[model samples]
Target: MKTRLSLFALLAAATLAGMTSPSALAWNTLNGQKPIVIAHRGASGYLPEHTLAAYTLAIQQGANFIEPDLVLTKDGQFIARHEPMLGGTTDVASRPEFAGYKTTKVVDGVATTDWFASDFTLAEIKQLRAIQPRANRDQSHNGLYEIPTLDEVITLAKTHGVGIYPETKHPTFHQGLGLAMEDALVARLHAAYGNDRDAPVFIQSFESANLRYLNTITNLKLVQLIDADDVNPDGSMSLVDPYRQPYDFIVAGDPRTFADLLTADGLAFIAGYADGVGPWKPYLVKTVADGVDRTGDGHLTINDRRVDGSTGVIEAAHAAGLEIHTWTFRNDASGYGFADPQAEMEYYFNLGVDGVFTDFPDTGVAALAAVPEPGTYALMLAGLGLVGAMARRRKA
Candidate 1:
């Protein structure tokens, strides 16, 4: 349980302290200030997801953390992408040669037919171009980017003075091929950032097996994604027939079960390995009536704090000694269920979730500044000089 981070990275991270996050300087400190500034898919609002250009721009935008959702290549190398398929987010289907790589599989209990990375090797994957997933977003930079490797991401972030928060996507599905994504990822992270679980970098996953395996591998701080399956008064990990087993067994005999994790005891067990929990948005504050979104708020909500304070999921997470963070925040019209970006974030802020994931950092940063203690902003500015000095010194 010993984690060690390089002093150089500490100085580099110092420049990112005092982010505009709601918690700001109240969160953990590394040598000084700096709230974790995670770039949602490499400043994705500005560029395509998982592209090196996107990651580079994020570092330039003063993001302390650059997120690269990890997927494995056919050769077992890890690359950044929101999912295994490249069709939706990248230009894959259009490619003539990769026609064979197109297929379908049930992912997270949902059927998806697209280009899967597991179907292609590293060489073939690099040949494809990444496109902006949202047409209404930005697309001017499309077709000019190449897929990047994990090492490439690390090296890029190192030069810009930042760390990556890599989430292991679909752990069990990938594990079926004897491909241990978490183990490989943690090993690489430790090799790159050293064996510091407390390092500025974070490794998170929706799968508890992924997180637990990471805990046993490296001291890197881990995070568990709490979704509908992770919660239930019955304390069942998952109602999905395959994921609800209670023994040291597998899903349809694959050697892992959703039931293996997600307990009051399971959450506690995870706390031993991770420092935070990224729960479903509804878990913290949602507006639901007969499973319908009533009133002005949307249906896919996470917490009910507008009135019932004790029933809020954020409070529950805090009671469990875990800071609450919710995922997939974006100001783009597609994600705003309440029909207003400002109002949406205001709802989350009122609920007291520790942090949020947003495609638009500027929007989130602005929202964070409006909160009570934006002490991290001061740290970020103070640290700015260091980052500039480093960037300049390197340039010189």
Candidate 2:
């Protein structure tokens, strides 16, 4: 069985040999550049996330960037974990000795009862190990990797010559805990990569104020992440409670929802403080529940939703001079009318997303490779002719 990747490589190689113009295969991205593949939580689909091993694997997998969601520790140090909560992504729950650290605190308005990273010192944190939070993912590597600090993740990114897309997870919550990460994160990033706007670093945040604050302190690229709770059956986004608005918005009594950020006015507002916008994939494309099994997999699922095409967010962002990077493309779990994860990514890439945050970097890479660059239709037609000729020869 010839893999799709192998097939794409053959066609692409054949197409490239006769190409005269370098711009023949220009991408549809904001700057006509190839879309970047950011390894979300460091190739998270294949490994326990946020460990040095995971980060290293992501770099090895040809990711343009490795993402590390940053949270602070008790001693004012930045570490890579999905959130401050250690119960889900680490072995802290099983370690009886450090059991006293378990407690309840409201994180981004939800009362979360778990072992938080902020309660543990950097030295204490080292004793704990990483685990696969998702029950559906591989679990054999659960106790094998240690939780890595932000410095370690940065070092790995620099060594591999890849970019770092670090999200400041729950900035408002971290600030209230007296473990504010923005200042320390900026200072450390500036020290390592400098304050250059073109540095191989993009600091992302769900909170607007923190990114606005970051803009004044550093010139490194900042992305305002737009998030939503869920997608309604009618293809509308569910803007419920905490996930409805940036947590900081709730704190400041702002009434705008995450969906509002995609408006021309909202994008123009974002362009003031950030270089890019990272909306959840659903925000960029429209999908509708039309009662048809698009994938024909028995029952209708989110994957069976009818894809209606771009919702104009990408074009709007580009119009505002903001790059669009969407999130959480997983092979095991694809959403919104996409059964094939690679094909799903290709669709987004075709729609001109500047980057994609995927757990499987290799799939993302392969998908990007499969996209027909601008002016490549002639080459594809030729490749198809070549395939037909080969088939006829084999038949003879």
Candidate 3:
């Protein structure tokens, strides 16, 4: 009850202050502008992800941008999906009619068995409904929303006056299917937002070659996404097969791990082609699983880890003239070093990330609002320390 109350109190103050005044707080962001909150998969914490309903809810909750991960259909039309495979995030598993459509295929070197979107036409896809892939989230929203195409998602964002951050999921794999995404994506985005670099779009991909290729064809903003398998107990990133390097890196024999991309030279290479970098959050901050159980949760979890502050990736990216946006903050999951998810985001904001991709946009908005002014920075840090102390005392 105390933790819940503390969170609500912070959110209330944030919302009120945000409504009453224009922000005069100095930010350490690349452009010195307030960090943007991107609805990771459209208020995904509440609704089944990638539904128009989820996106609309996020816009209502004050998200500055909505994200749609794209995969191609059998007809080569782009559709919103986190992966080219459709089984986990849709009702395809329950539909007896599409049973024969399920098969195994290799995606990014991993053999995945499921119903691939490329096997289904847009019309057939319409017969399926979106589902919450994460079992821990709300399940009632399942079977209520239809999968939306890139055109429809673009229209939604344009109508609402919010930006769209679209990730071209598995570009090389899509190309192998003869559904090369870059040209189609460029043409569609150009038609929607024109050939302007300032368009409210940030095209992102994990593969370097595709991003470099996109740099030549389109003037729209692009972000290079950096990924790793996991984080080690000592706060170092873990690099393993498949997740270790970008699939394209393996194919092209680039021989650089995801961590290598965060190095000064790597960020410089990225700066040549991308306006920004989107790294998994672990790459930005240092959180150590030192067995302290800071949150007093009987068992140590990621939340119980110690927050040792920024790992300097943010500053490095900024120094490289690239904005850094880290991701996938969710209220129901992955708070990292803090038990309160909003506080976790606030910590990142204070550390000077340019943007955050969150499943709970309302929480993200509130966290941004709650970030302290320069004079109040110490006060916020003190409050965070007090919370940790209280948790430890409770455990004692």
Candidate 4:
């Protein structure tokens, strides 16, 4: 309500939705189910990533929290974008006006050239429209939508009774711009959502520094992302080595590896700041076979039976009262996302995950519903009937 948006402006925008939704979903309202399914960039598989249309459809599809990758414009307004580059998610390459914006130095140790969001003011970005990036993926959504602002996203999410999980993309870089990305994001979110600690919204990031800073700023829940180690022969050693000494802690400035966090010492340290750890899929369950250990693309196999690696990283995190949710669950052939959404949710649910990052929330919600036994269903049905009767009496 404290947003800069005018009443009539919001009212006009609400008119576009045609139907107003309830407030945020209460976790108690989950009625005992699998982890919440957050749409990865708002049903990105079906539409252009981070567009209002993509976010809209995801809410209708039963996503508990719609995800938005937050990037700031030159004018200091935040927008939903996977990366600062416009070449992949938008029509910047085709636009001559933005050809000047095409330049890159190095990102995360990789040198690449592309159109950057920081170079383009919000006005220039508005001139470009969104298109599906992958050729093998759906391109029907090409040129259908424009990028949306953080304010636009929060408004849309509130109107639809959906929660938004925004990741502070490249935090270290944004802070370099003097924007103070996390402060700007949390201030805006709190103004609108009223600062409930477990308000169905989770602010996440790959970098640990942002999460740690956010812990000092607001009451909102924060998530830390962990990646896989390609060369580690033993997962336990890889996991434990991080906490052996006074190691580099933050993904920013220090750039410590995942091995640091997996250790008992690392986990105990991390639990001080975060409510959960969102690890890459590979580290959670490792597929294994007879004698020789197998490893390749699609999935990582970490079997403790032969490898002597206990999934104790998760246990360690959990014993410290942290939720262990794995991420980037997609539906692509690349196996980057979840293949069987139901089975994946079930697996994570069995693993005792508190949340899941999925490209499709509809599938995840259905899977969550299926987990409760018949007795739970009967109780739910009775509760619904009683609520219906009470509503009828009130109307009479």
Error of 4 at 253 (Å): 6.3
Error in Å for residue 51 of model 1: 1.1
The lDDT for every candidate, in the order shown, is 0.66, 0.89, 0.89, 0.69
Model 2, 63-173: lDDT tens per residue? 999999999899988999988899999889899998998999999889989999999999999999899989999999989988899889988888889999999999999
* Tens-digit per-residue lDDT, 1-396, candidate 4: 223224434443443333333211122122223467788899887888899999998998988788889988888889899987788889888888667778874545446698878877898888889988777678988987999999899999999888888888877667666657987898898998767787867888777767888899888888777765342533333443332211224333564567567677767767888877787665665433334333234444433223222355566677777777677666563221234657666565555566777776676777677664324433444455555555556766
Off by over 4 Å in 2: 1-25, 295-298, 375-396
Q: What global local distance difference test value does model 3 have?
A: 0.89
Clashing pairs in 2: none
Measured against the true structure, the TM-scores of the candidates, in listed sequence, are 0.72, 0.89, 0.87, 0.75
Off by over 4 Å in 3: 1-25, 288-291, 297-303, 373-396
Which candidate tops TM-score? 2
The count of backbone overlaps in candidate 1 is 20
Model 4 alpha-carbon drift over 4 Å, by segment = 1-34, 229-255, 291-310, 334-341, 373-396
- Tens-place lDDT per residue, model 3, 1-396, is 566646645644564455323333357789878899999989999999999999999999999999999999999999999999998899999999999999998998889999999999999999999999998888998999999999999999999999999999999998888999999999999999999998899999988899999999999999999998877756678899878988899998889999999999999999999999999998988877788877676887666788888999999999999999999898887656777899989999989999999999999999998986542543454466567557656876
Better model by lDDT, 1 or 3? 3
